[model samples]
Target: MSSVYILEPPTSGKVLLKTTVGDIDVELWAKETPKTCRNFIQLCLEGYYDNTIFHRVVKGFIAQGGDPNGDGTGGESIYGEPFKDEFHQRLRFTRRGLLAMANGGKDDNGSQFFFTLGATPELQDKHTIFGKITGDTIFNMLKLEDGLIRDERPIYPHKIIKTEVLNNPFADIQPRLRQVEVKEKKKKEKKPGVKNFKLLSFGEEAEEDEEESTRVNEKFVGKGKSTHDVLDDPKLSSKTEDVDEENDDVEEVNPEEQLESIRKKLKREHKKPVPTSTTTAEPIDTYESFLEEERREKKKKQFEEIQKEIQNVKKEYHKNKLKKKEEDIIATEKKVQEDKTIQEYKDEFDKYKNKKDALPKKGAGREQFTLNLLEKFKKKIQSMKDGEENEEDNEEEQAWLKHRLCFQDKNPVLAKDANRKDDDWFEIYDPRNALNKRRRGETVEKFKK
Candidate 1:
């Protein structure tokens, strides 16, 4: 007789959660699956994993958590038993603040679990590889993108205020993603310029002839030193040796007494004597060449009236192009007889969709045989409408509405009877059957024969 298994992981403490959306810290695989790590540390040490949540989220995958009725098949801690398959294989569901376990299909592991959000080799051999969130001060901000963390829920709702445990000390380091993003580095474009055509060879080109530029336009000289040449330019002085050292210290002012002091300040005054008629757009060389020969005879009579209005618009555009080509050949023979009657009704709807797998699907007792042939033709026209409207005795309530028929709405059992009622059987002048009153009594007995 021998079978000892003191499994102990019911949460030896250390569950820190405290989260508006971050901190967590699980660490309970108590020697691999010890009864699902002691039923998830005895349901987070009795407080049943506080505000439990992490529902099902699956962005990068895995964030689940101990349920507390937040759906995901809720749970508080019903270890009523079941757990043995640990399946480790050198444990390593890869990185990013690990933590595992969560099952229901096989030996239903307890106290659900999750948290990885990173490397998940196709969920290794299909789940149940228990515990790993070795360290969790938000595992140094758990960033692995495409799985956002900060506040976007997952294992996010944590806020356990505090937790503590030892003997494993926090040396599990292995986390990273400290922000990285960099990005903006894109400028390298400038390629459009390819116009090349230069062929010149008219005897090796070079012929610009205006008599060799007329001696450089007679040695061009206007402002080459005129218009008061910036105070008699000395070669436009850049302060000509500081004005010859301030004129070697003073006074050297008269160049012909500076042109008789610039012609006595160019004097002026008014001298009107008489004549003053002004208006002048003068081109009257012989009355403006006789009004340019009467404006070339009124522009040759408006170019013969615009060539008779362009031959009456080319004879009304060939009489409306032969009346629109006889109305487009009578609308193309009525669109080829409406495309041969729409291709003979699309070849009879492609022979009823290729005999739609041989029709005849009407049966399941053909709706109770069409509701017992429409309630025996509506109780033979409602007992001839209650024997001509309330002249009662409707043949035993029309045989009980023909056995109350109604297989899938082929409806029938409404044999009206609120106290011998019969307002012309809800009529617009009733007589709704018997083939419409025997075709109106054979059209009034064929008009009274």
Candidate 2:
């Protein structure tokens, strides 16, 4: 399929796009992406891109358009469906003013296309490049008023007013075949070895040093200039001529004129008046000076005393700060200890209460039998309490167990009333659970604990 549609390019082919900003001339790469060029040309000829907008315009990036829907969502080809991408190595998007197709994914080119504003090497081999923008229309478009550009979408609407093929001069030019990028061979790593030293003959060393000196001199003095080259330069030669003329025009002075000038200098010196020295008196000391000196000494001694006081104050403040911190630490320790003790008491209480509740109620058959059973139960409870005390001492437990054998539930039912008060055996705290109690004509408390 690729061999059947090889590009037979012309000398040159260009498309003139008249946009709202300016007219952009694009040179089509017929020899590179022949199918893309054909698709673009067919669309232009059919007037399919006349009113489309350049919906996507990213500054310093790309200006995309050619969607019939004007929002980059719609495009159609002369042949139904979409066409495959025609990529060529020479047709890369590595410079400004690049023309290429816009597709949803690989090889989905239709009528949509884009022109790059600068080099986009990252898009290489990703999009088909069938043409390149020419002329200064791109620069003009950049200068256009940007009403609003959000998310790279041109909200102001730079529509394609018109599109036409200006020229197609590549009718006979065939596209050079695409070439694959070849990987270069890696350099071999150098092995460890003794450094090689070359011996130079005495004569060779001298010659090399001489050559190096000559090169150094050339670098500093630059290339030697010919007579003609010097003469050709107006600024340098003119300045030299002016200097020579000035030297030649100098006049000579006579010895008698020099003597007369020296004598005149001596006479002028003698005629000048001599300046007199005026004496200045030293400053006299007064009684006020002594008093001022004494006052300054007193103030200096006072400042020293004040500095000592400030030092004492800072020391006192530091001591107070340390004392307060120590107090806070002691308080925090006491609070943590109290909380631990309270938590331990609560846990022990809950354990003891559960054990007491689990004990069997007084069995009803005979008073003597019940009394004997109660006595045995009391002894077992006492033994368990003694065992716990021996394992861990608890003041609260000792007080609680003192009345444990005598304590009883407030709603306890007698053996005779057990059958008749069966409905009241269990405490119902919630109102919903009181339905049965109400039906049985039994009184219910707001709370049962």
Candidate 3:
């Protein structure tokens, strides 16, 4: 159905694929796959498949070949590009000897093809089936021992010596063979007063020869006569009455007489005419006319002023409109920037909250740490009061006092008064009470020493 041109197969409509094992004749589906058939035949005639091996072979499946690499990896079409798969309902791989294209994926059928060892319905609609093995010899050859079919490679090489076309339809360009040549004769020279003529046909050539011979035999002669010899002179006649009167006494004249007549007429017309008696006319002035002129000037001035006022108004309106549009654009951009910033901040807050919830609670660790610091601080202060500590010890005591004062009574308060508080998990006023309770064992050990 495609408009692409295809080469008609030979009268046999089959190609003989001679292999190492045997020769298998295949009937190419020219009508169904015009482009694919044309490409395959061209490659065959060019000897591209010569010396190529059947790289892929399966015991009970299919045998693939036509790969130039001979490793089941490389092959290409005539166009240097892949061709689309052509599948038809009548060309199903439902039986053995079915020849179909080998492709990497959809519509990527290249030069590689396969022959089904048996019924391979699983391959239907996935590859382009372009031909089919025709004879019983090919079917028998397909059953030959292909050795171990590991990695889909034939252990024994089955090389394709060459493909042969029994009777190619386009073999002879011309029905017959012949050669042709044409030799042009040189033209004869013409005499002084005679014109040369071309010989168009056999009859014209004979007539031209006779005319040439007659002229050669004749002696010197003047130019031949024309039809004007029998007609009256054109200058002696006139088509109109005025023309006839102008030429009533006219006679044939020489070049000198014509020149003299033209000169005399030109001199007579070139003389300047005499000036006539005339007076200059003055513009009539009246009161109504003067008032009209004044009113016209006044209206012209007012029209110019009105034009200027309109221009100014239009300019002001255009400037204001442009300014408003710019302001609106700037405001919209600022609003968008603010929204982006707010979104970033919210994202950061969510990340921090998730991280905090995932971490192990350090409340009990902090309570034990604080109790150790208090014990150390009390010992250092008592040593300093006994004059057994240095200046550094005094400084350390001051830092401890600062820490204690900063943390004093800083715990969160409850909704009820402290007087209502009790030593229970719910009634405890301190936020760290849970940490201390968990570390009660450690606290008792420390106080015992």
Candidate 4:
């Protein structure tokens, strides 16, 4: 008796995805795909996947989500950029409820993830399988799959409400929260006319204006002096009267001339020598200079090595591409040769048919011609069958031959006609049935049912 082997889910890390439809419990395969698992765990803890809808859901394939944009275009890994895929030999999309990362291309793994609806052999090596549904969560996956519409999307908005980390293997590791700096709004400066509106009233506007004038006069005269005392000073009064008389005697100068004078004064001031200061220069550090030079040399050598590697890769790629082209050419040549041989047989048959029409109705010559034609056809078919047998080891050749034979069988000339039911030539040499029988190790005899 053989003992049954059961694989247990890992307890190292687990997460519960609470969604609009149902909750899904996932067991992370941390040991096999650590990077993918860690990335998913961090994104979940950071609430990056929260409230994100399943943007793409294909029935019987996968349920993709984790894109913040609600479309399939947005979302990034916890590393803040696309990360490389972590494909483990043991992990694969061999069953329903498997968790994997959805990528746009190679090494383009981001925050987007998907749940397999069934065994997806086509996606085995393409995606990184990091986790699997545990317990009765397969029911939730089924519900999700069933909700998909014709457009490969859920009819309703199916979103992940929140993610709860059950057990984290890297407990010490915390998510790198993005810091958004808020800009403060600046206060607007009030205009001088608007600022003084409160100081003046409708009724006492004149009195306030007078008081403001006296305050300005006292401020310039002296801090402790009143407007009356400043006006009572004889020397200040005489100076003010003389300045007013001089301004009245002087003619108003042209605004343009005043600006030109100011420009000249500024130019003269600018022409004056600028004061220079002297300071001691700090000595250069020889050790730091040496280290920098060595670092540059190392970078140059690394760059050169990378260039050489790129060249080698290009050479190998070109070589493989050329070899593939040569193989394709050889295959095409063989197909052309086979087509030419078939066309030659057809031309010969046409010639024989034309000759029979020209010959007598009841004669030995016509009968002999018909027999010869049938024998030639039989010989040609036998040779083709022998070729198929010789190339039985080559699957590609067999597939090509099978495809060609099926195409010929579908031709109007070879296909059975309802009007003329007596034609049994195609039945005896039916390549489709013969190929199937040969694959099953059955002996194929010429002109035998």
Model 3 agreement with the true structure over 1-449: per-residue lDDT tens digits:
12111232222346788888888888887777766776777777777788998888887788888899988789888767998888766666666776788999998877898888887878888988777777676755575435666677767768888998653434422222225477899899986884444534466777777777667446324555333432357754434345444547777789998999999998887875668768776676798799999999999999999999999999999999999999999999999999999998998789778966865567986677778879877876677566565456554346536532222456788685556656652643554565775665434446568
Candidate 2: misplaced stretches above 4 Å? 1-11, 169-449
lDDT of 2 by residue, 86-124 (tens): 887545555676778888998788889887877788888
For model 1, what is the error of residue 174's alpha carbon versus the real structure, in angstroms, after optimal superposition? 7.5
User: Using Cα atoms with residue i matched to residue i, what is each candidate's TM-score against the true structure?
Assistant: 0.19, 0.35, 0.35, 0.39
| Alpha carbon lDDT of each predicted model | 0.59, 0.74, 0.73, 0.80
What ordering of candidates by lDDT runs from best to worst? Answer: 4, 2, 3, 1
Task: List the lowest-lDDT window of 10 residues for candidate 4.
Answer: 1-10
lDDT of 4 at 183: 100
Give the per-residue lDDT digits (tens) of candidate 1, residues 1-449: 01111232333324555543556566555555555555555444445556665656565666676676765676633445656557655555665556777777665666667777777887776676656554545453353223435544544343333323333322332222236589999999999985332344542223343334454456555525333333445655433243443445567787898887676655321243457668777666998789999999999999999999999999999999999999999999999999999998998788778766454468886677678768866765676555544344356455545553323546578877756757655534557655778778745456577
lDDT of 4 at 6: 32
lDDT of 4 by residue, 297-384 (tens): 9999999999999999999999999999999999999999999999999987997799668875678977997898788657656766
Which 10 consecutive residues of model 2 have the lowest summed lDDT? 2-11
Error of 3 at 356 (Å): 99
Q: What's the CA error at residue 330 for candidate 1, in Å?
A: 99
Question: What's the alpha carbon RMSD for model 2?
Answer: 28.6
